[model samples]
Target: MGMTAPARWLVAVGSLLALTACAGTGGSPGGGTQRQIAVSTAVPDEPVTLTLAYTDDPPSKALIEGFTKRHPNVTIKPQMTPFNDYVKSIKLAMSSAQPPDVAQYNPGAMSSLVPAGLVLDLGPWAKAYGWNDRFPPATLETLSSDKTAKRFGTGALYAAPGGLSVLGVFYNKSLVKKVPKTLGDFETAMQQAKDAGHAPLSVGALQVGGFQIWNALLNVLGDVKQYRSWVYGEPNATIETDGARKAAETLTGWVRKGYVPAAANATADTDAQAEFAGGKSAFLITGNWAAAALEKQMGDDVGFFLMPGPTAEPPKVASGSSVSYAISSKTQHPNVAAAFLDYLSSPEAAKVQFEAGFMPVDTKTDMGGAGLPVEIKAAFTPVAQANGIVPFADYASPGMIDKLTPGVQGLISGKMATAGFLSSLQQSWNEHHGS
Candidate 1:
């Protein structure tokens, strides 16, 4: 939980030193396993430039700033892109004789990229570090490769959790003084808002952005009752089984009742955030990551609740890992990379992110008065503690979004039946990824 001076340097700088060397030979200025980084305390004989490539919101910048302070010789450079385009960009980057030393990637879809010979297996590093004893079971599974060996779930410990995540309703405190804590209460509140001439909930759907919310609903109501094939890849998202039917029916009914925005399918992430922040909608289903954004925008006016099911106590919630950091098998500096990962788990780094508006992946670490994002914490922590958590959108395959999202849009718009929509989902996934 504490940090030594040397550990801090690797945690910060090593994460981003993505400068490329020839493809087959990854040896850096100081030859070491790509996984182990020299402790920041030791002044490097010379500058070691490391390049890290990942999506736009990468922690590379923060890491670089933190790491370089301790090790003047270590310089971290970033190759950042949009989240949607990250998969393609990383692949292109890794293909060159020069590959990024470290990167941030999605667990489900991005793991498929591992087969390209770009990823370094973290097995040895993991054994040495023994995160198995420090982290939770689901986390290892959640942050690990993928769900099935038939797919991309296991290989090496290429990546691990970088932040905390949970599921629940993000609602406008100013709009609804009292939040709905139970399913009946939530539904009644939605109806009350409609009668009072305000949109009760705002969700993105069929649009490029809204697909995730659709899956969130599935995890909460659908998976809680019936067997869900997509969660384990036993069936798939498109299968019109009981779980799929129930999920679709619940969402469609809400849509027909005018609880959510009609055109939410086209709403972008920023737009949805804005609408929720502006108080145009009473509730937005989300996790803890949104805490920082909301705080900067609205401050203390918003509140949160664990989404309730149709049962007795607090409802089972939906949750998944938000993002993870991984080492490049192609990096000449494996030790540096591994050392950086160790730095990330340190209380110092965890404290920085926690106070900066994120959750700590290490449960033992306390927030250093930076305060956990209340809305997110309220929504997800109970579910996680109760062992009711599940995987995120890309849990099954990289192809899920394209196959299932559009059909969800149709169901939400009242153009498709619950059963019919689910039937189409299975067919679509097969069409794209093949059965």
Candidate 2:
């Protein structure tokens, strides 16, 4: 069977993208001769060692352990890089002569690798392992893209998601008496929190935390298909729209209403998260990646919810990303590497992925734990089932995060108008994908 509609819808939402391979591996993704490499579902019986480069911790380390445990003859060594440095350094690492056999995907810093033919196209393995049915189509879609890496969805299978994440609201239940039922109620709660001498929202405007807030708002307020097209790099895609402008205005209004802290622009994501966990803020808007940390800090006082919409009933839309992996064209063991990728969606791996604070690749798998994790899984189920999760806004272009962080910072500081912000984003997109 072909990819499901939800998978097709998420073609543009690349995340934790494995976009590179060692150079001189195969033909370009744009229609060049594809390497006729063989694939297999089994690893060799002899001793084998594969090196892995990644940034995320819990899932990568634990998943690697789980996979290696099943096949003692295989030893997978791991190299962990910090996020910012990873973005700047991964391209070089993957392009080096002795690149890791497998590497985690990071779209912004690694798009160049795809066009350079430095990454393996896993079409054969996907076909062999029947990944189309084993993993979520949307997760697979997030990794597949054209040769240019500018547009995703209808292209070679490059990476497979090891874990999934979705963005939503994390509230301090001790402070929010009633969870908001609608967008208006959400605003009212924030206002009350502010009036009661609490910061309504703790924003990390110094980095991605700023745009993440705007992104969550747009997920609820904007037209999903239009936003998806823009992120997907479809020709003529544009962020200049009524929904985006309204989301921007909504954020600005929150700032003026004293719901957002005055020092928001100065705060970093960790600091803002700390503020919320410390009970200084009524709510924190972020992804499930923070669930483990927050639960450790606040225990039962913390709760989770998707950002509400204008009506009592809200759309299930949310921005999400994945910790995906790809094989290198230079690997001596293509079949063995493919085996590791294929293991990602297994029931055993699902347990490891869930315990690592990510939504499992097998969305249908029950996350059999309790507390905040259970709450997150409960909130995430319907959205994943509906295929409502889209990629973060920065996935729109290689340098889009540079534009997003400062653009949303301007919105929070009242230094940038909505028109200018949208125009600037479009300018970046046009530069990368053409107007």
Candidate 3:
């Protein structure tokens, strides 16, 4: 499950506030003297205690336990915050005198920390741990950013992922008899479901779920580099292109054809998932994060698939995110923190991540599971191998989510034209990135 529209808005505002707060401080917020850290691949033998601040439960708590078991001398004090408070509070916490050594990375919410030089660049540790081989390149790309933190994909690495996730389609096995192999087949199946008096696609158009569907469509139809460039905030990158227009049109077309529920704009993500789980709709577009809940409700009646492209050979592309963490620049035990991050890529840690309901960062590691997990792995492995997974488009700018959520709702309600909706998105991009 992705962050809700309100959550994303909060993160954006929190990020701006963080940046403004940092600027007022005149330097790194704590005003500590800068110290150079010597990169080391090994953790110290002496007893050491480090603190970590995070929001997510499963991977964070489990990963910490795994790391402590391996290095008994080291103790990690975890400071858990709720997702709503995490973004706003974390900035202040990280800027404090006794900051956590390790903090979970929230790209949209914590990006301001990068420009303030409050987070350590993990480039040296990445090489020392051979992380390039340990984690998928595509996963790392989202965690890397320039010193300004505005551009992504080509800069010093800041965070390393503990767990990964991928976006795709989920179907009610009773409604969709055969899995769709091509985009045409997918539409036809949706139409057939509609003809049978079922809502073909369950959508939460009031939130991130709406734009997520468009995001998946663009991944399969658009130029990968162009989309990447736009999301990464590269110079002259623009989202007002043919492929994006086509994707918007396609989403609106589905709504006009009655394939999507009429009440989608009023629905919440969890409610949409509930409806799908109850077999009210034939299909749902979402991430692997929802697999556990779906499996519990649908049992063997649920199936997963990558969103197919126009051709039989579907595009090897998808949108995803990670449960990743960065070392605070103020940490005294940088090497120990690096060791913990490195441990995340290990086979043992991979098992923990998978069991915790996330895709393992180490794509090569075998995640042996039945049903939905297996289906997810089957779809994700090849994409990871080809380095095709990309970060969500809302990551482009702080206000981008504000545009996407309502823009999609407009499309669903027939309140805004495709061109107008797309222009509204570009306008937000321009306001953030500048014309």
Instruction: Using TM-score, rank the candidates from best to worst.
Output: 3, 2, 1
- lDDT on C-alpha atoms for all candidate structures: 0.60, 0.83, 0.84
Ranking by lDDT: 3, 2, 1
Candidate 2 lDDT, tens digit per residue, 119-139?
888877776556787776767
TM-score of 1: 0.80
Which tens-of-lDDT digit does each residue in 1-435 have in candidate 1? 244433533433344443222222222222343433322212335657778776756355665566566456777787888877877677677666787888886644344445444565555555545456544445555455431322333434557666556655777777777867667788788888778777887775634344555556666566542332354344344445665566667777788788868777777667877788887777777666676777677777777676666664765556566456776656766656655565565555656556645565555454534322744554555565555666664455556666567767777666766766666656644654457
Instruction: Flag regions of model 1 displaced more than 4 Å.
Output: 1-47, 68-73, 107-112, 146-155, 206-209, 224-229, 232-239, 368-372, 385-388, 428-434
TM-score of 2: 0.91
Off by over 4 Å in 2: 1-34, 56-58
Worst 10 residues of 1 by lDDT: 21-30
Tens digit of lDDT per residue, candidate 3, span 336-359? 887788778777788899888898
Mark the 10 consecutive residues where model 2 has the least summed lDDT: 8-17
